[model samples]
Target: MQDRFLADVLANRHNRAILERWDDLALPDAWLVAGCLFQTVWNLQSGRPPEADIKDYDLFYFDAGDLSEAGERAVQARVDALLGDLGVCIEASNQARVHLWYESYFGHPYAPLHSSRHGIERFLVPSTCVGVRPGEVCAPYGLALLYDGVLGMNPLVPHRDLFERKAASYRARWPWLRMAADAATPHPAA
Candidate 1:
């Protein structure tokens, strides 16, 4: 499943381009996460272009050595300098600093992350959680639910409001995606 998912993700030209330059990113424990990868697969499944409707590419890295907002900005600047010609939004987040602002932004306290994968594991939905770079495609919770199009709340980050919002947004875009029995019930279609 990992191989299949990875191949499907790379089928998107934008994703391919980013992974091709993984080494150039040169950040500690860095991985491209969330929407860009899983949504590519979703698009392919829906017979749409692989890169269609992808909002942004997310890049996460753990840098305990520098937790300041300025340090995170510097990393993002480097990413922009390197991949700006891709003509897409690429968000590079330093996982080490996420905890500092998570509470204010999300109305919940988030513990410090130990690695990029640790941050990836806390997505609102377990199935939607994935991270990739070069030879590595890390889906710590596996890909069964994702491939099955089932949105389930992640035990790792059990925030009902956040989960409902995220699931609703995804379902709004891809109506074929169904809620898992354990997932928060999605909002009625508007």
Candidate 2:
């Protein structure tokens, strides 16, 4: 078995079937609440025959809304039902929305976001570049499953410079939630 095969398996039609079934309902257009939309599923196709049938599934989602509890819970329920139907042996906590287990063919951990109380912050991944610097990329932002919705960085927000500048003044005012990243303007994604 090759990694290509595993990856292919994850990308196979069956996975799509499952996702489609999950989508039968009106699920928010994001996965994990905030990070990146479900770009593509990651297959666990390693070069091992014993694990050929086993492929890991990776789903992504990002914050596109300002803040909404109803939206987060709706998304979380859909994900939970899908994973349950797949018979995934997941370890989930109501206190924390992080779920990880080993029942699927691939032993990849799945995070079922419930909500974030304090909300989350976004950062650059330090890998991709969208402008002048070819080697520069946005850092990985932080996400928390608190409140009745997922709270994380808003990727679609204003430019970093404007955001950083606007957020800087609050740092001295609010010590607990310091704005360590560059200051940017405060504008909600439309």
Candidate 3:
């Protein structure tokens, strides 16, 4: 994999601390994998002359089990406190996932963490579920690492479908989350 432009931007104190320390967390292995992929892609995209830029770090948690309100709140509070201590701004959506945005005047988490189902296979191991962004016109530095020792080219934008057979065998998860989410609310009789 190549080192992305975002790496340079996040190389600062706060982000560097968070990125380096994420592995130490006892959260599921999938969390670590997803976080790794997100960070890698963000770093790459941030450096390029972009059609878009990452404004905040988004962490999407894909869990098959339904969490209770108390459980969710506890998790969010813990994550928020950890981020606060790191001097980073953290927020969570109604879904109970954490979103870490850069607090520095010029820092941002521009890259988004999008996830989908791994199907019937045993993806419960946190290290399995990973996110992938599309390739730019010209390959970014260290992009090869994203492939993780594989010889292939992925066309999925913002995220690629690597193991389709596995994804297909099981139920479809997170089908259109990004598509349904928008900045605007419903129009009034327009």
- CA lDDT, every model vs. true structure: 0.88, 0.30, 0.33
> How many backbone clashes does every candidate have?
0, 29, 22
Who is ahead in lDDT, 2 or 3? 3
lDDT score at residue 178, model 3, on the 0-100 scale? 20
RMSD of each: 5.0, 16.0, 15.8
Ranking by lDDT: 1, 3, 2
Best by TM-score, which number?
1
TM-score, each model? 0.94, 0.29, 0.36
Candidate that scores best on lDDT? 1
Model 2 scores a TM of 0.29
* Model 1: residues with Cα > 4 Å off, grouped in runs: 183-190
**Tens-digit lDDT string for candidate 2 (61-176):** 33444234455466557666766566532221121323322115233333433432212222111111001011111113211111112212235332455445434532333223
Q: In terms of TM-score, which candidate is stronger, 1 or 2? A: 1
